[model samples]
Each structure stands twice: as C-alpha cells, then as structure tokens.
Target: MLRARPKGRPKATDVELVDVVVGAPDAGHVRVENLVMSVEPYMRGRMGGEATYAEPYPIGEPMLAPTVGRVTASADDTVPVGALVLHERGWREHALVPASECRIVAHDDLPPVVHLGLLGIPGMTAWIGAERIARIETGDVVFVSSAAGAVGSTVVQIAKLRGATVIASAGSREKAALARDLGADIAFDYHDGRVTDLLRDALAQVGASGLDVYFDNVGGDHLEAAIRVINDHARIALCGMISIYNAETPLPGPSNLIKLIWRRARMEGFLLRDHLDARGEFEAQMATWIRMGAIRPVHTEFAGGVAGAWDAFLGMLDGTATGKAVVPLGTLGAGTHGGNDSLDKEANR
Candidate 1:
C-alpha cells in the first residue's frame, strides 16, 4: 500500500508490502503459491493515478499484476490441487484467485517463467503488432524501435521468421549489437543521429526499398523517422511511446506525421488484452518457433521475493534491467523483509 501518491518519480517509500494471510479457498476459488511476478512499463501508467485504457491502482490495497504460480489448494475440480496456473493477483507470495481468472498452464517442457515473457504477453504483443496490426509480409522491409527490449526484440525475430528484412533500432551501440545478434538485418542506435537519416541510409546500404511495415515501440523520434521513410501503403503498429512515459506533460507531436497522409500509410495502436482471440494460434506458432530455434526469450530475473518488488519495479522504471523485469517470489524470498520500511534507506533517497 502506498503511504502517499508520488509527486514526480515514484520512490520505494511510496509503496509498502503488507502481509495478507491466505486461508483456505472458498468454492470456485483456488489458492496459489506464486512463482514469478511480472513488472512492465504499463504499471507506470497505473501508478500515475490516471486511467489509460485501465484503472488507477487503489491506495492501501494489494497491488495487482500478472502472476504465475502453483495451486497449493483448490476448491474447484477444473483447477485441481498441485496444478500450475496464471493469475492477476501477484505482488505477493500467495493469492486466492477466482477459477475464471486463473488458467491452468502446467507443462514440464516449458518453465512457468516462459508463460510470463516470450510465451506470454511480451511475445503475444510482438506477434499481434507484426501480424495483426502491421501486417508484415514476405519480402517486406520492417523497422522495430527499442529493438533491445522484450517486445521489440521479439518483433525482430518474428519478422525474420516471416521472411521480412528486419531493421532494428536501439538506444546504445551494445543494444544495437544485441539486435543484430538476434537476427536483425540492420541495427542502428537511435541516439546516433536523427533516426530518419539513419533509416534512409541503412535502407540504401541494404539495397532494400523503403519500409513496408514499422513495429513502433518508441514513439517520439522513432515515429518521426518511420513516418519519413515509410513506403507507400506501409502500415505501422504503434505499440508504445516509452520515450515519454516519464514526461510530466504532453511532449511535441511527431513533426513528420503528415507523411502518413503523403505516403498513404496506416498507423494503429494496440493492447495485447484486446487481441486474446488469437492466443490459441499464437501459442502454437510460438511453440513451433521455440522448437525450431526461431525465437529466443530475452529477459532479466531479479532473485528477490515480494519484499524486493518495489526495488525491482523501480529498477525497471529507470531502464536498468533489459528485456522484461521478472522477480522470483519463492516462499523463502517472500519472508525476508517486512515492507518498504525495511528497504535500504539509501534507495529512498
């Protein structure tokens, strides 16, 4: 529970992890021992106390996030005891989840963490952005922004799998190299210069036509660049605008947005929750890609329980951890600290 809402950047003191004892589950409810908890960029918007296709996190309440766990006890037959499941009542070691909100996903071949990263929202998000939103095609020239992050990196591999020429952008040279290692045909650092010029030159170097599709994860400068060089009828999947996630107010709009009209291009934003209708198909295809070594899950795992959640979340907000930020909430990892009051006082400063 937050003692008070944040004034600027959030602090460890703003959040306190209170213990909630989990008694036996009621009928139709399953008690789960959480294994892995997810911390993503969207949670930052939730903490801002404004609704953006979602509601604000209520103060003095147990925080909510997608969690993968094992059913220690079950009151419903569909979710039997000892089955692994995914639920949204994370932020803690144990949770009582409604059977409807919990999905059984116990597979010995695939670890539970995969269900939270590549095989989960991040992977599905990339697939939706490419196939559904951007409509990537064979022989198409594609550009992905924030290409070192979870979703953008997955977008790179998925584009390669679909036989498209993948152009990936990262914030630093090291990240750009990682993008190239992940099969991006061309990887450039967005910080090098105006990304517009870089995209144009990279296209020339590769002897490819202008971008046919753009998997846009960084919106400000990257969006402008993509709009500037996009081919006629090119489509853009507006996945995120992380460059401005911390801005106090609206920043400047892309100067080249008019290119959308000039080139007859299309840009659309999407949330993976709205596209779950494709989950069954995405899961099967993603499994195949994994078996064929087409897609690799990239993420950072923080080995602290719920007590470390506030710090782990802060680390993600500061861009310290690459890919998806995951915290392993083992039973022992949970009981190490009392709450934010126990956090290193220096972290609060």
Candidate 2:
C-alpha cells in the first residue's frame, strides 16, 4: 500500500509490500489466484489521494487494478473453480473477489493476458475515442499522440481501418518506428524537435491542410500542437495526459484555446468507466478485428510474478514500456494464439 501521498514523483518506498492473511471468501465471493495484472498511467492519479473520476487508493490498503486470474475456490456455483476471470484486485498474487464482479473470460483460443491489454480497457478506450468521440471518417487526417502506447496504438489502427490518414508521435525513435509499423502514415519522435514544428512538417508531408481528428494521450505540448493545426469542425478525444501524470503541481492549459473557436473544433475528455454500456459492442468489433489480423496486441511483460508489479508500474510511468505494461504472477503464457508474430518479435526486442 501507499505510505502516504507522494510529494512529487512517487518512489518505490511509497508502496510497501506487507504480508497479509487471506481468508476464505463469503457466500457470493471467490478466491482468485491472479495470473496476469496490468499497470497503467491512470493508477498514478489514484495514488495522489485526490478527488477524481475513480476513488483514490486508501492510505494503507491493497491497491486495486485490472487483473486476470483463475478461481481457486468459489462459493458461487456460477463462478466455478478453475474458471478464468477478470477482476480489479491487482498488486497482489491472490484476492477475494465477488463472483458478481468477476467476468468469466474464454482464453482457449487467446492468451489470458489479452483480457488485461488488447481486449480490455486499453482496446475499449481506443475504440471509444476513435469511433465515438473523435468520429473518425474516411479520408480524414488524424493525429495520435503516444501512438506507440497501448490506447494510442489501437487508435492508430482503428483510424486507418476507417480510411483516415494517420500521423503519430512518440517519445523515442524506436517507438516512432513501431508507430509507423502500426500504420501511421507519418510518425515522428517528439524529442526530435518542437512538437508544433514536427506536427506541421508531418501534415505537410502527408499533404493534409489540418487535422480532422486528434487522439490525445499526452497533453501539454501535444494538446497545444493539435489545437494549433485543427481543421474546421475537428474533434479531439482526450484519452489521457501521461506527460503530466507525475507532476507535483497543476500545469498550464493549452495556450491556443482561441483556435478551437476559430476552427469550430471540439475537445472532450472521456473516462472508460462512463462508457461501460458499450463494452459488449466494442468487444465484438475488436474481437473480429483481431481475428482478421487488422489489429495487433502490443505489450511488455515483466517476469517476476507479484514482485515485478511495481517495476512494471514504474516502467509504464517512465515511458520505458511500449504498449501495456503487464506483470505475470502465475504460469499463464502471454502469447496471443500464435498469431502476432510482430508482437512476439517486439517483445523479444
């Protein structure tokens, strides 16, 4: 659990690993042996003990996260023993979860870890942002920030599938290359130069006058750049602001707000929890895309079981992770049914 509210960037010591006794579940609950767990950027905000879309983690309690596991013992017949499940009880090897809260996952054809990455929150988030929020259209020129990361990578492919010309930016050259491989018509490293300048060059290279859609994963400079180049009636989906997730104080907003008015553009921030009603629709679409080889899962797996969860979290926050940062606890293979050769190759790198 977190020792206290972090003063600046959170440190390893802030999260202590203490042994606790695990009791048998009640009538409606089951004991899950976690197989794979996720570490995402939003989790940083939860540790701040501030009011947000999700409740903050308690000062000295187990940190909750997206986890895929199997039921070792179940009090409810609906959720049988050895059944694979998805729940939010990560940061620990085992947890007592309500059977009602457990979503039984079918992993016979796919890897169980896919429930924590490509077919889970990240994939759904991308679908919501690209299709619903941004309303990507054929021939539209789209810009995606953090295009090598989990949600951004998915957004890139989705926008491309919609027949949009995709431009992307990443923190490193290697990540930028991955973004291009993911179907970005133009991909550049944000560190190469000023973001606004790079974006302008990318747009010119693609012969696009301005952006029709912008999927923002990094805020601050990236948001400012997007606002500067948006076409009339453009839509921007604010998925995350990873650039400022660790900031100790509030950062300034985009300086180009007036451009939104001039361009008649819309910028909206969305949380995944608010869009749960569309999960079934999103899952069906993404599953088909995965089967057709139109979408590829991207993730980095840490291999120390429960002990590696913290490292995975830190790696994700520090931009060392390419897509989703996952930690494997039990012996669940992270492969995606032997389909994603590119994903397998990237993982080896």
Candidate 3:
C-alpha cells in the first residue's frame, strides 16, 4: 500500500498511488519486491495520451515499465523464490506478475540498474539497428542523433565496436564533447544554426562523400540533413523523433525524402516490443560487453519515493535528464518512510 499520488509532469495523467495489497501467487504467477524503476520517454508518451509505440495510459490505471525486483514468492517452480527478475511492473513498492513476463538476472559485478538500461532496451535497440537495419561495416561513415542519450550512446559504442567511423549530434556543446569522449570520430551541436552545413563539414572532414549508415534518434531536421548527406545505397534506422514528440500540431513528413528514391536508401523504424521474444540472446551479448568493460552505462537518478516518481518522469519530458531518469520509490524523495527520509530532509535544508 502507498500513501500519495505519484509525482510527475504537469501534463501527466493517470497518476496516483495508495493502498494496495499483493495476493498470493497463483499458477505461473510471481510476486516481486521492486528495487528500481526505469523512467523513459516512451512512458512520457503514455502519460500525455500520445499514441506512439504503445497504448496510452488509462486514467487511474497503474503505470508500468521494465523494473528490476526480487522474487519474494513464486507459484511457478521454474522461477525460484529468491531470484532477481525484470518484469513490466509499475511505479509501486511491489508487484504480482506472470513468470513468463520476467527474466532472471544474474550478473553480480554489474549494477542491477544496467538491466534496466545498457543491458536492456537501450543496448538491444542499438545492437539491432546497427547490425541488422543499418548493416554497419568497417569504413562506413555512420551518423547518430541524440548521441549523448541512452540509446544513442549505446549505438555509438556498438557502431565503434563494428569498426565504423561515427559522427554524433547532441543538443548542447557539453554533450557534444561527451560524445567525442565516448569515441565519436566527430560531434556536432544540433541547436546551432545551419545543421546541414555543419553536417556537410563533418562528412568532408572525414574525407567521405556521404554517410553510408545513419542511426536516427532526433528525426525532424536531423533526418532532413541526413537525407541530403547520405551516399548512394545508404541505410537508415529510424529510432525516434524527440523533437516532434511534444508538438501540439501534427508534424510534416521529411522534406528531403526524395533522396531515398534518388539514392536507393533503405529506411526502417522499429519498436522495442517487437524484439521481446529475443531478450535472452540480447541479454547474453550485452552482459558480456558490460562485463568486459567494452561498454559503459550512464544514468541520472532522482531520489524520491513513489510521490517523486511523477516529477522524475516529467523531468525527462522537459529535457532536464541526461541519461535514464529513475525514481527509487520508498527509499528517497519527499516522503518519509525509512533511512532515506533523513537524507531527503537534510538535502532540503
């Protein structure tokens, strides 16, 4: 049971928290004590009544995402009672879920949060886009938008692993520098005037005619520039368009899409849900890379109880969060539940 409404964006709907009890696990069901909650842009879409990759959050319904939790009880013998699992539990202290919906996580040296991030959706999205959609190869000039964000950063690392020369874009100069530090051959500030000119120079600096593959995250203008700068027979993985996400009005199609016809470029868009069946294989590969120190996971954590979950979610919507924004309910934030309350109070003073 919880005491108050979940904190989130001003525009957020379907937000609340209060008295709830977990029932004993039934056949194929497992009860979990959630330890970490993943705050992501897709969740924001659900809050806004926006129809993106999934359905909008129903009013008064509990919001859910990929959460790491400890199994307190299990009805299914296949899932042990003490195992750690990741399931589509919401911003709550506990959950009861189906056994098939959860995956056991066993990487001890790696932080459990990585299972919500690098070793999870962000990592897999980058891997599939680079390996399958874009078909990244040695000597290929790959351009990635939102290079400093979770999925974008993962793409940069995996593309580098594939021996491709990487060019990345970020909204700020500081983020651009961070991308460069993360092995990007070139980094550009997207907020600067004349993005196309800036990108042309980046391509020219690399002694390339045009980009062979593009990992797109910011789709509007960035997509426009990419269309103009792609080589013949290029490939593009349309990840997401954060720029148009908040627009009250509808967005127009890419103006430079004609390049696709002229250059015979292949462009495709994907949703993470489509790849859920292959979670085991993706986890195996990502865990190896994380354990090998070949990849680094970054996150911005917001310390707040269940009440703070709403605010942390809205923070991501406002572009205030750098990496993954998370809320550790019951342990941090405005509520006084335990030892975490003292830290929250002292910080306030």
* Top TM-score prediction, candidate number: 2
Candidate 1 error regions (>4 Å): 106-108, 331-349
Clashing residue pairs in candidate 1 (N, C-alpha, C atoms within 3 angstroms)? none
Tens-digit lDDT string for candidate 3 (18-79) = 54545678899998877778777776566655465687666666777778878888999878
Residue-by-residue lDDT tens digits, candidate 2, 100-209: 99999753367876788778999889998988899999999999999999999899999999999999999999999999999999999999999999999999999999
lDDT at 136, model 3? 95
- Residue 197 lDDT, candidate 2, scale 0-100: 100
Q: Pairs clashing in candidate 2?
A: none
What is the model-wide C-alpha lDDT for candidate 2?
Answer: 0.86
State every prediction's TM-score relative to the real structure. 0.92, 0.93, 0.87
Cα RMSD of predicted structure 3: 4.8
Tell me the whole-model lDDT of each prediction, alpha carbons only: 0.82, 0.86, 0.77
* True lDDT of residue 40, candidate 3: 79
- lDDT tens digits, residue span 1-349, model 1: 6565665678787888665456789999998888888988888777777778778788887778888988988899899888888888988777789998998873437867788888888889999999999988899999998888889889999999889999989878988998999999999987788888899988987798799998888788788877888899999898988888888888998888889999999999899889989988898899888878878878877766887888888887776666777888865354444433332223332
Q: Is candidate 1 or candidate 3 better by TM-score?
A: 1
lDDT of 2 at 53: 75
